[model samples]
Target: MIKIFTTIFLLIIGSTGFAIADTDYQLHAELIAKNTYVFIGKKEDFSMVNGGNILNTAFIVTNEGVVLIDSGPSYQYALQAKAAINEITDKPVIKIFITHSHPDHFLGNQVFPDASIYALPTTIRELKTNAESFLDNVYRLADYWMAGTEVSINSILPLNSTSELIGEHSLRYLFLKGHTAADLAILDETTGVLFTGDLVFHNRAATTPHANIEAWLLSLDKLEQIRFNLLVPGHGEVTGNISPIKQTREYLTWLDVTIKRSVMDGLSMNEVINLPVPEQFQNLAVLKSEFMRSVIHRYPIYEKTLFEQIE
Candidate 1:
């Protein structure tokens, strides 16, 4: 613990003794487990302050090369992430996995274009269909940080039907639509580490522009059945325990119930936004902002469903 803290302290305080090349760099990697490292992004919302580096990316060093979980939010951020990985090992990144169709998760493909990029076929379809509008919106939200970032994933090979073996490691890919149309969770059978894309977000309010709440909830149950030694989320800290899964489940359940009740009560969007969150979720970063966005995206569906049921 002390060693990890010391390294972070030096990087943060810009200690001249440390080997960090740029003192102003935004992301940092934490050694989470044997042969595994995670670059946890900011828990805050998209902003110039964070440069939209608010999505977690990780890499595992293997005998053949490195396997990157997700590129960061943009081209520049991915470059920074790769540089950080390079500081430790010169092994080239052999593979890239897009956990979902969200812009933040896949736009960084431009930075790591050398590797074979893979995503669920459904994810590829969504990106192909919505990439234009999504990129436009992401450019506005992330602004300067995404200045040069364009959708570079021309063809994301379908990651289906089997595990890809690299060296002695077997990467078991699971298709989950909990967080988006397609959320990919990779389990490193060698290390028992599960890279759970955005299917699980800890210590932060989850964004749900493309989420099916019911499907996402069932996905959490699937997570409970999986065996993993360490869990790395698309945002927040890595954990050795399943507490993060519990956190995600509770938050989603509360959000679903609250939104459904608000719809039944005929609450306006603003009223739903103002509704108090459970105390357990009050401290999460960007809680209100994300919750408001989620309401805007999902509440109308509930309203329509209730209207049809009444009819």
Candidate 2:
């Protein structure tokens, strides 16, 4: 099975200009708060080396059972996460929350068959629409690690609810958008920890393939108002302050302004792609590549809007 998938992966990625490398799959859960742990992934893009483990997945242990934040990129990753969770506690995972439809965040849904996997209703709609394409892409990028991985969801979490008590933790669900059409931010009211999903990327460039910058900035504002002791971003390291929220806001704000300015300046896509990144964002992981991607994803829309204004 592994060999078959690998051969197919090589063929698909080769055609799509992807290259493979190597990286270990070992995962360790870092305890961020009392009874709360997070498995931080690399602050890099998906590669065979990282095997698509480029997003943070977390868990909280409560008296009833364990609550998992996101599954992960592949079955292997979920297995590693489960093993890591077991090392710390023997509690069974009773609930799983998928923050968004991003493949790296939810591909491992099959691994937790018993856990009640919940995604926002819109998130479920997105997974239903895009899971197959996402699966194909991950297989092409991660190959053997993606074996047996398939899109799976057991429940749709309504966006209307404000909070729910599971185990000893009171989880407040924030249904907001900007990162995608449906993004779920989970706040552990009991632990004062906020899992901001992909809405906030710390020390890493935010991806905008499905981004609505205006909406995203609004979501950031909402997150800023929420008081939390620690923030676990979908990517990057955990922080005790709202620095991540501020950083994401700054980046998105800059991206929106820059893109609009460039379009109005009549700059071509290539020019925008090669433009120098601001000094502040220079140190972000995958800064250049993600910026380039954002340009490619958003430039045309900006161009179209400007054209419409003149028309």
Candidate 3:
């Protein structure tokens, strides 16, 4: 009877892949620099297998306490992240900074109720206005992995650059945009680690759900001017070089030109999705899917702008 029950359980899990996504998030922290660790996420889109763990979340172990960069995807992810942090140090997380208003970056805010959560005024406003819908969308994609997760933001980060001396680290915040209406990039003056939110995607294709290509290019230019020893992007691995910024710029430039050309050529959205991808961007993770998404999200705006110009 026990053997039969075990077989039945295996069958259930095999038949439905989501049955295996039990509560364990399996988070591990990777130390990148002196007292700085990053929880690198999978380079894939949201699915039942990855459970929305497709973005980076990092924490800085300072003299005072832990300073968290982004909260991650869900309540379970935050719990597991906190547990992983505990394995390294017992200090409480004093501050949680949400880089942008993306669901993958800030949904884990609920688990850190004691910590003060901060984001740009635009981020806070975006969360307040669209968080529920974003939650609904993730819940659909990740299923049970999003259990008990809710939208939470406590404080608003200033819309301009600011500085804070926390413990042994001197932090400088850069307010920039292009990936979204507002993106926050943090430069740790003490360690030279720059955390550029989703403003830069290393080997992964950038999502244009809220992208402003023109503004995004300008933000990248600003980032290239900053001298940083290490860069922790919102997605992909941490790097010490400026290649990621260049890669992101190249892709966004291509995307802008492609979409504008498609509109001028009177190509349908489906046609644009089927357009040939350049060899350089072919190696990017989720290239085709992200390109399709970008077309669906941004093509209509280009179409409308071209129409207005013709009028």
What is the C-alpha local distance difference test score of each model?
0.83, 0.88, 0.89
lDDT of 3 by residue, 15-109 (tens): 68844536576788998999999999989998878888999999999999999999999888999999999999999999888899889999888
Model 1: residue 60 alpha-carbon error in angstroms: 1.0
* Candidate 1 per-residue lDDT over residues 1-311, each given as its tens digit: 44335435646555566443232336777888777899888898876567677888888998999988887677778888888999989999988888988877887788876798988898889989997787778666755566567788785788876587888788888878878878889899999999999999989988888888789988888888899999998888888888888998899889889999999998898999998888899988889889999899889999999999999
How does candidate 2 score on lDDT? 0.88
TM-score of each: 0.89, 0.92, 0.92
* Stretches of candidate 3 exceeding 4 Å from the true structure: 1-20, 154-161
Question: 128, model 2: CA deviation in Å?
Answer: 0.6
- For model 3, what is the C-alpha lDDT against the true structure? 0.89
lDDT of 1 at 267: 89
The candidate 1 region of ten consecutive residues with least summed lDDT is 17-26
Cα shift from native, residue 74, model 2 (Å): 0.7
Best by lDDT: 3
